[model samples]
Target chain A: MVAKRIIPCLDVDAGRVVKGIQFQHLKDAGDPVQQARRYRDEGADELVFLDITASVEKRKTLVEMVQKVARTLDIPFTVGGGIRTLDDARAILSSGADKISVNTAAVQRPEFIAELADMFGTQCVVLAIDAKRRLGRGNRRAETGERAANVESDIAREASPTGDPEVWFEVYTYGGRRPTGRDALAWAAEAERLGAGELLVTSIDRDGTETGYDVDLLAALAARVNLPIIASGGCGRPEHIYEAFVRGRADAALAASIFHFHRYPIPVVKRFLRQRGIEVRP
Target chain B: MMTRILILDYGVGNLFSLMSAIQREGAEPLIRQEIPPDPCFDGLILPGVGHFTPVSERLRRMRSAIDEVIERGTPILGVCLGMQVLFDRSEEGPGQGLGLIPGAVVRLPDSVKIPHMGWNRLHLVRSNPLLHGVPQGAWVYFVHSFYPQPEDESVVLARAEHGVSFPAVVGRDRIFGTQFHPEKSGEAGSLMLKNFLRLCRG
Candidate 1:
């Protein structure tokens, strides 16, 4: 049997690592190459580097940073953000990245997914989705009170209304600012049908919270999709990883804040998982 | 005479980078689309890229040359697409391979991703002279869609994972195969090539 994966995510902007609370107020973390080496040494199963600002800036990719990290670390790393064309994907792979994660670009051109899989193979392309519960009726009063009417209308246009305002999650793109008004589960299934090798599902509400993974959402998505699900968001404790694998049935779990702050070393996390009867590579 | 390594080229591999790495290690490497029928080199290196179906077809066209070299007991190393061609057949395309090794190449499941690209750590399953000094948990670079599923597991030297490990490295006497590219794998990859040269010298 294959062991579950423990991954560390690094958000890169202008060739630097940055972490933010719920994708807002970004702050520098460190040099990407250095952070990548640290995660590898600490026993991270794989690493994910997102050029968080590439799309908005309209660039190809952070080639130099990716090359530097690839040279420094021996673990598998996936590069995401601003991968718009076959040429962009090829350039990243040639620069030494093992995999390329496509989100907005793939959604914009579904044929690009098949082209990537056909050219580089399916395993090399990962589809990342940022999901949040839709606003419900119960939350309408609080939402209106919190924001001006114009802003509230904008939010309403972007987010769907769940029967109960308190219980909805909306799909967001452009670094979780633009709402796509699509259900997370439906989008995930469509991505798989379009030949996505893996799905990196993230919860906007729980991101950077460090409370725990959105287990209910993860389980529901995992149940519906046949592709491997990478549960992201709010992985604060060691036990949270095991819970994601055993309970949520996620093939891998990705965390940023706890790992970036050195709250838990990867080897220690793997040891804990192993002791709990989960097969983890030592 | 110095040992000369011939890198069989089918115009499909990233040979420029591979050839540079070989030269960096102080080894003589000759890139040829057609191996000389007389088997002139001390050892042979089969380097490949792209899909297996086309690569295998090219090998079939050069069958006589490949057979002559293999029969001479000269050590051979196959990398990535080169390694897949050693199997009995491949589901990658129309089917049929060199049959140098017993196995079949199949598509990786959608659950694990098709091209298991990246730097993945290897788990050594058995000992082989070709892998001398290579640590059990050493990491190597990989970029491929179809993997070798050797019918005989005994030849498997190292295994790595995407969903489940097939075989990262395999060896049987003088012939060897690596699903990962040693030439592009940095120091560890260079060391592996050196080890193969040493095997040829012995």
Candidate 2:
């Protein structure tokens, strides 16, 4: 059986590790290499380094910083942000990243996902979707705080004949700054068809809040697509991570705050999950 | 003398992880597009992260050279798609594999996720030098949509199941292949690489 993955996401600004609430109010966390090594030592299954300042600042992802961090760990590493073209992705992968994730550029041109998957097999192409619940009139469930009875209802609404979902997750781009208006679940299915081997679905509304993962979003996406989903955003506690696995059906749970702030060490979280009968790496 | 391992690049994907892992295990890793004519390195690794057809086409160009390396008794370790190419062919695309191992690659069952991405346990089939320190049911990382189906079951040293049972590790004499990425498999992977290096030392 494939064990559920516990990934530590490091939001890098310039080159240092930083954590922000809802992708704003950035605060320096630690050095990227040091933090990455610490996570590896803590028994993290994987690491994701998102150069938060790259796309917004028009600066390239720090290749030097990526190389430094990649050299310290033996596990898989994924780098994202500022990866607009194949050359940009090549630089990061060559520097040692096992996978390269694209968000903003991919949303702008959905074909970029196929291009990346074609150039570098789908296995290494990860589509990072930043989605927020649409609380507008069309999504009454969000406004009224009405949760779907289960994943089945969420799927039913997503596939409703009217095609106007009462509740929908809107895809966001530019690191959660711009809403693309694309339904998150629909985009994920399209991404899978475009050859994306995995989906890193991050909830922009719950990002950095440490509240919990958008289980509805994750469960909905998981049901819609066969690709492995990595649940991101929220995650205040080990139980939250567990919820992402059991309720959300996420193959992996990615967290930054809890891991970065030492609120819950990876081993502690893994132990917590293991005790709950979750299959985790020992 | 320090063991030197030549990792065939093929311009496929990232070789840094595999190279760094080997270096950490006390082996000097040299990257090259083509296999050196002489068995200069103690072992060779065909790193994979690309489509089957393109990668197979790339490897087919060095077929005779690779065969010569194997003839010289140099161990070759193929990983993921690299392992797929050791077979006679693959269902992923139209191309001829190295055929060093008599088998064909087939798509993983659809009952599971396509890529089968994540860590899974390895069920030991039989002992080989590659399984030296690896514990039974040890977990390893995998990221591929297809897996090899060897013609002879004797070659299979270990197996793993996603939706169905499939060979996870196969070894026949010096040539070995792992469906999983040992380089990225954390400790168990490190141990397997160390064992491969031990084989190279001899």
Candidate 3:
């Protein structure tokens, strides 16, 4: 059996890793390469560098950072964010990233999934789905409380078999701020059909909250897609990882804040998972 | 003595990390679209991670150079899709392979989930230089749905079970192939590459 992957995500802002990165003895969490090497050694199955600074020239900055990280680590590295064109994908992969994750670009141009799969092989392309929980009767995007009256009919809303109004997760774009009025489950099914090898399903409501993974959402998407599903966002504890694998049935779990702040180093997390028979890679 | 390794980039997959890994093992790594007219590298590396058909077309263009290097008995190591292209054909693609080795690439059994994208334990089928410094049952990273089934089983150097028992490593004389990406396999991978470098220098 393949071991369940434990991944730590690094949020990159103009080539530097940020977001709760300072803590303990690891003073230099700013350098992406050093953090990458440390995580790789600490038993991270793969590392994701999410480029938050969305700009034209920052793409080049992301590429340069990928080159540096690739030189220092042997583990699989993934780059996400601001990749809108094939040229953007090309520049990043050529710089040595093992995979590139696309969210808004893939949603805007769904054909972009197959195009990437056709050019770089399905294994190197990861489709990122930012899902927000729909918790009310109002037809609006989650968190924003804005009206999505016109776009409501665009996504199917199934009433529960018991006849009560059902809640479904809607896919969000542009860092989960803009609503696409599309169900993430439907999008995942289409993404697999479009040749995406993996799906990184993130719960926007749970992101940066560390309440725990939206296991309910993760479970829902995992059942819908044939590709490997990486559960991202709201992972504050090692038990969250265990739940993602055993309960949510996610192939991998990704966390950022806890690891960056040194609350739980990767090796300790792996050990925790292994003790519970999660079959994590050492 | 340093070993010079030529990495053939056919406009498919990532090869930068592979190049850096070779350099870390104390070898000179060079990348080119095609085999140079007068190639001087001690070893040849074919690294890829995409569909085998396009890679087969690219290798078809460099057939003569590849054959000449084989005739010269220079070491060649193919990784992942690079390994699959060494065979005569693959079920994943339409085109035929280089036919350097007598074999065909087939998809892993449906019983297992693919792309087999995780770390697996390698079971050595037979003794080979590639496993020189590596331990028995060492864990290596793999990310492919199809594995090569060599016509001559004697060429199979190591086996890793996925759904069907598949060959993880294959070799015949100076020619070799690894289904997993050694460049990403960490210490065990570095040891394997270092051993390959030694053979190239020898």
Candidate 4:
């Protein structure tokens, strides 16, 4: 049986690991290479390094950082954030990152997903969807333009067997700063059809809150697509991660705050999950 | 003498992980686009990551050269797509495999996720020098949509489950292949690489 993954995510800014709450107020954590080695030694299944700064001037730094991490760490790691073009993805992937994740670029132009999957194969292309629940039915505004057209046709072509979603999660872009007014579940289904290998769904509402993973959001996305989903945001404890797997049905749980601060190490969390009957890598 | 291994680079995905992994195992890794007509290295590694058809086509172009190396009994280890190309064909696309191992690469069953991308335990079928010191049910990382189904059952040394039981490790004489990326599989992977190096040492 495939073991459920416990991933420790490093939000890197300007080549240094940083921690942020709800994608704001960044705080320096430590060196990325050191942090990565520590997590791997602690038995983290995988690691995700999101280049939160991903600036044009900082691209070289990010690539260099990836090379260093690749040389030092044996475990597979993903490099994401600001990867809008093929060149950006190539730089990171060739430098030794096993996977490349895209969010805003993919949502802005869905064809980018197809191009990436065609170029690198879908196995390495991950679609990270930053989503926040729509507060009320009144807040649910219909999306406009190409995305709206794509979503409507996508829904009609592959209508959910479970019927329409009871509550809708709104898709947010530009690191959760812009709301596209697009349905998160609908977008995920389209990404899968567009050749995205996996979906990393993060809950903006619960990010950094430590309340728990948005199980409702995760279960809804899992129900909509067969692609592996990595549940992210709002993981404060080992039990919270267990909830993400059981209730959320996430294939993997990605946490930052808890692991970064050493509140609960990866082995401790894996032990807890293992005790609870979760198949975790020892 | 230090073992020198040649990693065939056919313009697939990254080779840094595999190269570094080999280097960590205390072997000198040489990356080349073409295999020399004469085998100069103790071992050859075909890396993972890439579509089956294209990679297979690329390998097909160097059939004679690869066979020449094999004839010398230079131990070869294929990883993921590398392993798929060791078969006769793949469902991924239209291309002929090297057929070093009698088999065909087939898509993983749809009952599970399309890409079996995560850690999974290996169930050893028989003991071999390649897995010498590795446990019976050790976890290894994998990221692929298709797995090889070797026609000769004896070639399969270990199996793993992802919608169906598939060959995780296969070997015949001096040729060996792993469906998972042992380069990225942490300690279990490192130990396997060490064992492969030991095989090369012979």
Candidate 5:
């Protein structure tokens, strides 16, 4: 049986590991190779390094950083963020990354995803979806402070919406700053249809909060998709990870803030999960 | 001096991890892009990644050098694409293999996913000294669209199942081949490499 995975995410910028609040206000963490070695020793099932600044002119820095980390770490590591082409994916994989995660690039050109899967195998291509709850007409004012429209024609349109509110999770690109208005669940299903072997779902609202995972959101999405779901965002403690496995039905839980701050070591978390009867690779 | 293992690099696969793994097992791995005229190594590792056609062509181009090393009875291990090249021929591309083993490499049946990637348990078949002490049913990492089908079943050391059970590990005396990558298979994989190194001692 396949054990559940515990992944530590490293957000890299300009060849150094960094973390931010809601993908902004970055702060230095430490050298990526050192951090990766620490996590591997602490029993991390896998590592995810997102070149958050790969989109900028300082892109070569990511390849160098990944090569450094790969040289030191023995476990599997995934590199993502700004992987726009097959050449970029090949470069990262050649640099020793076991898998490559794509977000913006995959959404813009869906065929690129399949082509990658064909070249590097489906298990190596992880599709990450950043999503947020779209404000409905009734809750529009609550979120955006827009005055309620009172026109008779506007009222009629609001009364009969196109779909269920449960299906209204909107897809966001550019690290959840741009809304695609596409249904998140629908997009996830389509991603699997397009040969994505795994799905990394990140909640825009709960990211970096360290409060807890959005269990309801993850559960709903996990229930709809058949592929392995890697729940991301708001993992503050060991119990939160347990909740993700049991309640959210996530096959793996990914954390950045708590792990980066040293609040929870991966070995301790894996031991706790194993004690609680959760099957994890030690 | 510690026994040195030579990793034959034909410009196809990643050799960094393979070199690291060999080092981790307490052996010195010398990565060579082209087979050297005077091979100075205890064992040889032919590592290849990607499509079979180009890899076969590249191996044939260096035929004299490769044959020289093999003729010396250097314990050789072929991984994935390299393993496919050890067979007589491959249906994947229009190139003949080195014919180190009597088999034909062909694409896996369409019933299973094209690239069978992920961890699968190995079922040991013929007990060989190369697999000495390695536990039965150990999970090893695999990533390939094609697998070698040996004409002689006795050479198959282990088998694994995806849609159907196929040869996962094969060997004929000093020449060993694995469809899965031991360098990337974690602790169990490292153990397998250690066992292969022990064969070099003899």
Candidate 6:
């Protein structure tokens, strides 16, 4: 039986691990390789390096960072952000990225998903969808500072899968700063059909909030797709991880802040889940 | 003597990770994209990625060169698409594989995910030097859809279940194949590489 994976998403900017990743033996917060190696030693099943700085000038730095991380860590690593075209994906993969995540680019040109999948195996392509719950009447913008695009009128809003009007979430791009107006669950299904190997669903409203994962959203996406769904956003506690699997039925749980701040070491979290009877990779 | 393992770079798969893993094991990695005239290396590693036919096409011209190494009983280890290319053919794309091993690479049942990506535990069905010190149920990273269905069942070294019980590790004589990427599978994978290096030393 495959065990549920616990992943720590490391944000990379300007060729450096941006945030302070305080592992039990974290040598430095700036060294992505050391931080990743520490997480691997602490029982992280996989890792994701999100290149927050997707500038053309920083692309070369990110590629080198990917190679360094690949040589330093043994766990499977996925690189996301700025992977817009096939060449972009190739540059990362050839530099030793096991899998790549395409968010805005895939949403803009839906065929980009299949094109990358056709080049690399589908398993190597993970479709990252940012979904945010729509409030009663406000559609201001995402606070994540991502660029906004006027895609709200592209698709008509459908009935929420849960059949609750207040529960509907619209898909967003550019780090959840822009609303694409696409139904979150509907768009996730479409990505899978387009040959996405996995769905990385992040709750824009809950992201960086660290209250807990959006269980309702994850549960809905998990129910709609057969592929492995990784529940991201709002994991403030180890129990939240357990809840993601038990309640959301997510195949994997990804958290950034909790693990980044050393609030709970990955081994401690895995032990907590294991004691609670979740099959996690030891 | 440093065990030298020749890694084939068919212009399909990236050899950096594989080469780095080999170097970490204290073995000399000899990489060549072009087929060499002599199988002078102590062992051979076929590291691959991409669709079956395109990758297989890269291996076609090097078939006779590869066969010469196999005929010499030089230890060879193939990972992912590299492992699939050892089979007679594949369902992924049209074309014949190297046919070094007797089997057809078939698509995994649709009941499970296509790529079968992630870290899955291995159940050792039989003993082999490649799995020397590795524990049973040791987790290894897998990322592929098709698996080799060897005509000879005894070739299976270990098995893992997704939708069905598929061969995770297969061995025939000195020819070995791991459907997963040993270079990326952490400690357990490193041990497997070390074991393969030991076989090369012999």
Best by DockQ: 4
Q: Is candidate 1 or candidate 3 better by TM-score?
A: 3
- Candidate order (lDDT): 4, 2, 3, 6, 5, 1
DockQ of each: 0.17, 0.76, 0.65, 0.79, 0.20, 0.62
lDDT of 1 by residue, B1-202 (tens): 6668898877643354466556666778888888887656778888755567777888888888777777788898998878889998887788578899998988677676444644567888998887888887776777666788988989899998877777989998789999988875645677888899888776
- Model 1 CAPRI quality: incorrect
Q: Which whole-number lDDT from 0 to 100 does residue A47 have in model 3?
A: 94
lDDT of 4 at A165: 43
**Chain A TM-score, prediction 5:** 0.87
Backbone clash numbers for all candidates listed: 13, 0, 0, 0, 0, 0
Worst 10-residue lDDT window for candidate 5 chain A reads A144-153
Off by over 4 Å in 4: A136-146, A151-166
For model 4, the TM-score of its B chain against the native B chain is 0.97
Off by over 4 Å in 5: A25-27, A54-57, A118-123, A135-166, A185-197, A211-228, A246-249, B1-4, B23-42, B52-69, B84-129, B132-168
Query: Could you tell me the interface RMSD of model 4?
Result: 1.0
Candidate 4 clashing pairs, residues 3+ apart or interchain: none
Q: After superposition, how far is residue A113 of candidate 5 from its true place, in Å?
A: 2.3
Best by lDDT, which number? 4
Which residue pairs clash within candidate 3?
A: none
| Model 2: docking quality category | medium
lDDT of 4 by residue, B1-202 (tens): 8899999998865888899889888999999999987667999999987788888889989999888888888899999989889999999999899999998999999899879999999999988999998998999999999999888899999999999999999999999999999999998999999999888888
Per-model CA lDDT versus the true structure: 0.76, 0.86, 0.83, 0.89, 0.78, 0.83
Q: Kindly list the per-residue Cα lDDT of model 3 for residues B1-202, writing each as its tens digit.
A: 5679999888774788999899888899988888886757899999966788888988998899899998888899999999999999999979989898898999887666667887888889799987897887888888888989898999999998877789999998899999999999988889999989988886
TM for every model, in the order presented, reads 0.76, 0.93, 0.93, 0.96, 0.77, 0.92
Residues B83-193 of candidate 5: C-alpha lDDT, one tens digit per residue:
889998988779888898998988776665445655667889989977787788876777676788999999999998877788999999899999888886766677879
Best by TM-score: 4
Which regions of candidate 3 fall more than 4 Å away from where they truly are? A20-29, A136-165, B37-39
Per-residue lDDT for A35-117 in model 1, tens only?
Answer: 98788767777789888774444344387777676655555689888788888887777676767898777655667888887
